[model samples]
Target: MHELSLMGDVLALVKRDAEARGFAEITRVRLLVGDLSNALPDALEMAFDMYKAEGTAMLASEAQLALELRQARATCVLCGLDYVPERSAAAAMCPVCRFPGGRITEGEEFKVLSYEGR
Candidate 1:
């Protein structure tokens, strides 16, 4: 769905980096996805495949894209306790004391891990 557009952005970023780095071919692209990021794993991969078929004229048609998800975690603002909250309250306040606002310690990540090119 929207992952298609997200993937396009990712590919475009890689293409720009490759050009700036002077790499003629990009062999691999790695992405760091968070569980709470709301980005689906399967859909992201499918988007990459679609982009490859379109031959963006930047990345090699055979360029590989890897998506890796990180576990979701949060830290309690009041107790300073760290735990994984349920999907329902990931962004809400701490379940225990409901004190300070829940801050995401992990997950909710979308980044390029690494890229291999020549």
Candidate 2:
């Protein structure tokens, strides 16, 4: 459902790039997906099949997904302590010096690392 829409968006972006760069045929697509990014690789592949139907790019294209694991970061505003968050804990707090809320600094990103075509 959502993956289909998401795949549509990705295909649109890729089509724009292909047209702008004069890529006649897309051979492969390489994507680096962050752990926090709400995308399932399997679902994306399935969605790609549905979205890219009857397209030039679809005839020779396939999406290659690379999952990126991100470490949770917690930055203490009170003491400026930067530390990795524990997976078991719901929220990460400063271990050395207790802080009310340690600001989360990373783990939210989705991007296309590379696309090979033409």
Candidate 3:
């Protein structure tokens, strides 16, 4: 699965960071995921659980992976207006002018917010 591959890459970076900083045990990892990033939160969690303690020698068995969804911003194609809709998922059309198929300005990022280690 794509989420599995993505989680592998994330854990690799975390392990590298932990090694460079000489952390004894990784406790938690927080990620910011965008709505347009095409990442399923549940699948990502399951994937992370599989590898959180694999490559990282110092990772705790109970290490937590947390993901938060970032709000999406859309710009109207016709009106050239940018706005954040009340509900992003149901906002395929522009809320203000009823424009169809707005281009996504944001909410396409998948970034590691922070990690806690001892």
Residue-pair clashes per candidate: 0, 0, 0
Ranking by lDDT: 1, 3, 2
Residues 63-84, model 2: lDDT tens digits: 3434455555778888999987
Most TM-score-accurate candidate: 1
- The 10-residue segment with the lowest total lDDT in model 1: 86-95
| Model 2 ranges off by over 4 Å | 49-63, 67-69, 86-92, 95-100
What are the lDDT figures for the candidates, one per model? 0.82, 0.65, 0.82
Pairs that collide in candidate 1 are none
Q: Can you write out model 1's per-residue Cα lDDT over 1-118, one digit (the tens) per residue?
A: 8889888888788889889999987888999999987799999988888877777736677788788889988888778878776777526467678765667889989999988888
Candidate 3 local lDDT, 1-116, one digit each (tens): 79998988887788789989988778898999997788989999888877764644356888898898988888989998897755535655887789878888888899999998
Native-to-model Cα distance after best TM-score fit, residue 109 in candidate 1, in Å = 1.0
TM-score of the candidate numbered 2? 0.67
Q: What is the Cα-based lDDT of residue 42 in candidate 1?
A: 94
User: What local lDDT does model 1 show for residue 58?
Assistant: 64
